[model samples]
Target: MTTPRLTPHAYVLAVPDLTRTTAYFEHVLGFSRLWNDGDNWQALGRDGVRVMLGRCPDAIPPAELGDHSYFAYVEVSDLDGFHAEIAAKGALLGFPPRDQPWGRREMAVATPDGHRMMFANPIRA
Candidate 1:
């Protein structure tokens, strides 16, 4: 028997305001506007990475707002270059890229709705 291959298609994020969130992803993160339902759903992509933004007022409960309720960790091919580009675009970077003990170089940023997004690449030996 052979194991089947699985791949990540997209990430759906619950946002309170789809329009604003969509714009952030497009302008700040350099994601191209793919499509939208014109109501509550929008999709964005960049370099094979796709993210779906859905309007959901109750997505993050009030109580969870104080804590890390949602986060996405994406693997990138050029972590340093990507980080520099994002910074040049004036995105609010949570932190600069740092090498982790887990053998990944990672950087983090927070969305307007407070969702944490982390971009990482395997550290080369």
Candidate 2:
């Protein structure tokens, strides 16, 4: 038997406003629609990242989760270049890209709902 290798397929989110959240991801993060089911569900992707949204109008907004609302730390290359690209697209990032002591270069972006995604790349010597 072989050990299984794992990779992230998507991150699921419960959102109170699906349309607004979807638009933020598309317009700000440069993701494109992968699939959608009118008002109930949607999937968006960019590069190799995929995010799935489920409409949950009665659920507590992600903003209410505080530290528990962090979305994901996506792996990406060209950390600074990606920062410039998304920032120009009007991404409301929480922090600029910086070299981390953990040997990665990283940045962060947040949705109006207050959920956050961190993007990182391994630092090479």
Candidate 3:
């Protein structure tokens, strides 16, 4: 018997407003809306990245308000170009792109529902 390879397909996030959050992913992040339950759940994809949004206000605690500790890191081929595109779309950028000590160029932004997303790319030699 041979073992099957494993891969990441999607990540689900609890959001307060499903519709608003879904729209953010679609418009702001350039993700295509793949499917929706018409109420509580929605799935989106961009390039090969997939994300699912669930309507669950109670799942997100109140104390950890605006910009919670949870963050999603996305690897991009062109960090500067990606940053420029999203910034032109009015994205709420946490900071401009900068080279990190770990040899990656990164920029962070927050979604409408307060989910922090970090976009990064390797610093080429």
Q: Evaluated with lDDT, which candidate comes out highest?
A: 2
lDDT of each: 0.84, 0.90, 0.84
Q: Candidate 2: deviation at residue 10, Å?
A: 1.0
**Higher-ranked by TM-score: 1 or 2:** 2
Query: Over all chains combined, what TM-score does candidate 1 have?
Result: 0.86
Candidate 3 C-alpha lDDT tens digits along 29-109: 899989889798999999989999889977764226655644578899998998889889888788989999999999988
Off by over 4 Å in 1: 61-67
User: What alpha-carbon RMSD in Å does predicted model 2 have with respect to the real structure?
Assistant: 1.2
For each candidate in turn, the TM-score is 0.86, 0.93, 0.88
Better structure of 1 and 2 per lDDT = 2
Residue 69 lDDT in model 3? 41
What are the per-residue Cα lDDT tens digits for candidate 2 across 1-125?
A: 99999987999999989999999999888899999998999999998889999999999888889888897988887888889988998888889999989899889889978888899999988
Candidates 1 and 3 compared: the better one by TM-score is: 3
For candidate 3, give the lDDT of residue 108.
Answer: 87
Total clashing pairs for each candidate? 0, 0, 0
Candidate 3 local Cα displacement, residue 17, angstroms: 0.5
Which candidate leads the pack in TM-score? 2
